[model samples]
Target: MTRRPEQFSLNLRPGNLRSRDPDARAARDFAARDFMDGGGAPALETGRTRLLVAGMVFALAFIVIGWRLVDIAAFSPGGEPRIAATPPAPAFESGRADIVDRNGVVLATSLPTASLYANPRQVRDPAGAAARLVRALPDLSRTEIRAKLSTDRGFIWLKRNLTPREQYRVNRLGIPGLYFEREERRFYPHGRLTAHSIGFTDVDNKGLAGVERSFDAVLRGRAEPLTLSLDLRVQHVLARELAAAMTEFAAIGAAGLVMDAATGEVLAMVSLPDFDPNRPGTAAPEARFNRASLGLYEMGSVFKIFTVAMALDEGVVTLDDGYDASKPIRIARFTINDFHAKNRWLSVPEIFMYSSNIGAARMAMDTGTAVQQAFLGRLGLTRPADIELAEVGRPMVPSPWREINTVTIAYGHGLAVSPVQMASAVVAVVNGGEFRPATLIKHAEGERPAGTRIMSRDTSLKMRRLLRLVVRRGTGRQADAEGYRVGGKTGTADKLIGGRYARDARIASFAAAFPINDPRYVIFVMVDEPKGIARTHGYATGGWVAAPIVRRVVERIGPILGVEPVRDGAHEDGGEELLVRAKARASKVATN
Candidate 1:
């Protein structure tokens, strides 16, 4: 109705009145305003609520990030997130000290080396890697390397003791799984010259032979570097001379030693046909034998020294004592004859100078078995040398001490001792009657160990004079150096094989001491199965073969040992006057 009135009263239709109604118009306007305000507020509130929820989510996320940072910084084992530290490299085992000569020349030393190994777990292309490795190390079999690499095992050794160049080349390949372990390899610098004394070590650096084996514990950190008593210069000279002799005489073998009589220190010891300690595995058993200390033999006339010393020490005979040497002695199917029989009565001096078996047997009979055994024991002939070596041979003494044994032993038969024993015993006789234990180690300062007294100083002096006489005029005359007053004895004994003695096979030997007045050095030379040479008058006796060796050794080493040579006087005519006087005294005794 209001809408109709507002239309200037033009519309009389009901539809027009409905359209023109004021109450209807006002209701419609109110509904439209409510819809606009109320609905819009709900939509805006929903949107604001969604934004608040998003802010909460952001705050929660930041808390979690901060907590994790705190935990990592304060609670972690590796604090403060530092760069990882490289582990320290492991150290190598400390090496043993070197063994040097008296002149400080190197004899034995250790060299650092790399040993090849493999970590099979890290291997890639196992066959190819092995092939390359085999090529680098020809000593290793290719098939073996391939098998080792292909295995499921963790570790394996490819090779050991590679040279520096080899190690470098192997490393250059940079192949996976291949690695190296540090090790020490022992070396003997002088080769075969000092093989017997210096010795050799095993693959694992353990000492196995000669001096190395004897002192293994010391070399393995139990003690310090073992300073030996060897002199390299003297050792070289001795080996060279012995080799020359061996070649010239065409002998089966040879051995020699130069020892200090005053101290029992070995200056040089050489065994012919020796092997280099650096390559000991390639040598044969015979080459490895130490003839000077391990090969015991009947030492021929050199035993006479012990016999005479025993007689004198026991007061069985005097320097003037005499025995009938008119013929060979007969005992138990054995005949003892002098090689150069005088066919007359002889005194003690003549017995030694002429090397008469009959006179020596008579002297032993006077001394008796008890005194002889005791004397030999004192002289260290019945036991191994008290040295730091395992190769020493114990003397072969007759199990039952019979009368025949005594007689044969007196003449250097039916008894066997190493040349080292002979040299040590001889040193005791000439070095003022003291039995100092032989040593390979050097003595400390101001420490001179006292030795057991085996004989009177006077006896030692008399023995020296008699030995001097022998070198001057007796069988040992060949051993005399022109200026050096040398004294020694010659010995030639039949070799024992399979319990029977071979008369043709002989062991010729000589034992000499220089500067006879005050003996300082003792030299021993032995030739095994030496053949008779034309130059030696076809004789293989010690005087012909071993004596010349001693002479050369004395001449060479005399100057080195500071022993001055002197002119030979009438008394220096080795035991000649003593022999004549002994013969005269024997004649007089026989006449009585």
Candidate 2:
């Protein structure tokens, strides 16, 4: 500048200046020497090189960082972490599928619902928020809700499955932390109408009983509705009639079902004292029982169908065969007698028509225990009923099936089976001797599963004639439907109470197959502990109680099922076939 300093620094001085201090003079001499050695330009170049190196180092560092970020985002494997600019968009999910009957009537379905939740930490005043929530949902406990709101949790469920009005009320309060999350709730449109069969779901939409529990996975995996073999109309008729019978007879409970004899498809099933599946928690435990498939009972004379079929199929007895049912067979403190006793020698047809227990027991003994056991197994009566229902009951067969057991079981006493199992076995007896497993799944039009042959076609035909004869002239006469040619047997078994039979507490039931000339449907109805009234002449027997139910159900459902009605003498089996053919077959067997 204006004047160059004599020394640039305290330790440096220009060579032209003379310093007084010795050290200063030495520093000036060294500075002059160094400047001369480097000529000053070299030192300036060194400093500029250092600055360039530093700039390049910083540039390299920034380049490496930028490249790493790009590689991660563009080339990283799916298993590795990748940086995302934003969260993914939500997807549209259709919840659980619907359940419908064969006619497309909705029985169960899922509906989109909003569930109330809250961020407890965001709640400004716990007491105040709970107070407002209680006003909207009175069912929610105020104390419990207040405690939940006071928690430090970031997320909490205040209430689940809120109604639209409830959600509105909560939203109107404008609570800061409260929010609504979308959810789906299972709904049973038919309610108690199909409670035991369609089943119910929990609050989280998980199936809990009946067909729902059995087909839970299929329901969640598919979007299309599930179709059942059940016909809603038939189900309604069966339930209505059963309920009326239950009321009229003052029965403790009732169960009934209608099965396609040829196909083994259950068209309708009903268990009285049923509950509303939509509000299952509010119903009594007894009301939720599935009696048709789960209740095991000694089905009295109904078992005679199987006994006679077994005897006929095994060639142990013929229609022309006779048994002495005049005297009661007293066996080891047990007596086998007929409810409608005819104290005389009776033919097989007469014994069946009269429901003679002594005759059935003698028939079973002639067939032997092992043969009876095998025969029942072939009919699918010695095992659990093969159905789609989750509540199916296993048959209670004697472990060491002895002569006494056989004798008692012949008349439907020692062995206990479910209504569904009995019906399925009866289907085999009347539907051309083929045993088809009962199923709830719908089949294609004109399609039916191949059944296992348990008896000969001839035996099946003979059995059909006998069933018609029973309805025409036996204890099941009341079960006959005009023009339907209903054929069945009546069963009245005393319920076992406290290890003893209670005469008053009886299981009255009837098993029938209609249009016996060409059987279409099989019907079974049971009333538990029915009290006899004046109308029944103080008789709570199967003929007086359950037979009427079968008749009414058949008359109403026959037309619905498209079964043509036949006039008397018009049906194929209207003649004396059982009498004429049995005599001829007996003569032929005797001649052989």
Q: Tell me, by lDDT, which candidate is best.
A: 2
TM-score of each: 0.77, 0.77
For 1-592, candidate 1 gives per-residue lDDT tens digits of 4553444343434675467667656655655576678777788789899989998898899899988889887787875447777899975455666788776787988888899999888998888988888778778888888888888889998888888999988998899888889888998889899998878988777888888888887777732456788888888888888888888888989988888888888888989989979988999999999998888889988888889887887788888887888988888898888897888887787778778889989899888888788888998988888867889998899989888889989978888988788888999999999998888777764566688999988888878877776677678888888788888888989999888889779999998888888898988889998888899878988888899889988888888878877855634445556767776786688788
Runs of candidate 1 exceeding 4 Å displacement? 1-95, 117-159, 168-179, 567-580, 583-592
**Global lDDT of each model?**
0.83, 0.88
Q: What tens digits encode model 2's per-residue C-alpha lDDT throughout 423-474? A: 9999999999999999888888899899999999999888888888888888
- Clash count per candidate: 8, 0
Query: After superposition, which runs of candidate 2 have C-alpha atoms over 4 Å from their true positions?
Result: 1-92, 117-159, 164-178, 568-592
Q: Lowest-scoring 10 consecutive residues by lDDT in candidate 1?
A: 4-13
> CA lDDT of 256 in candidate 2?
93
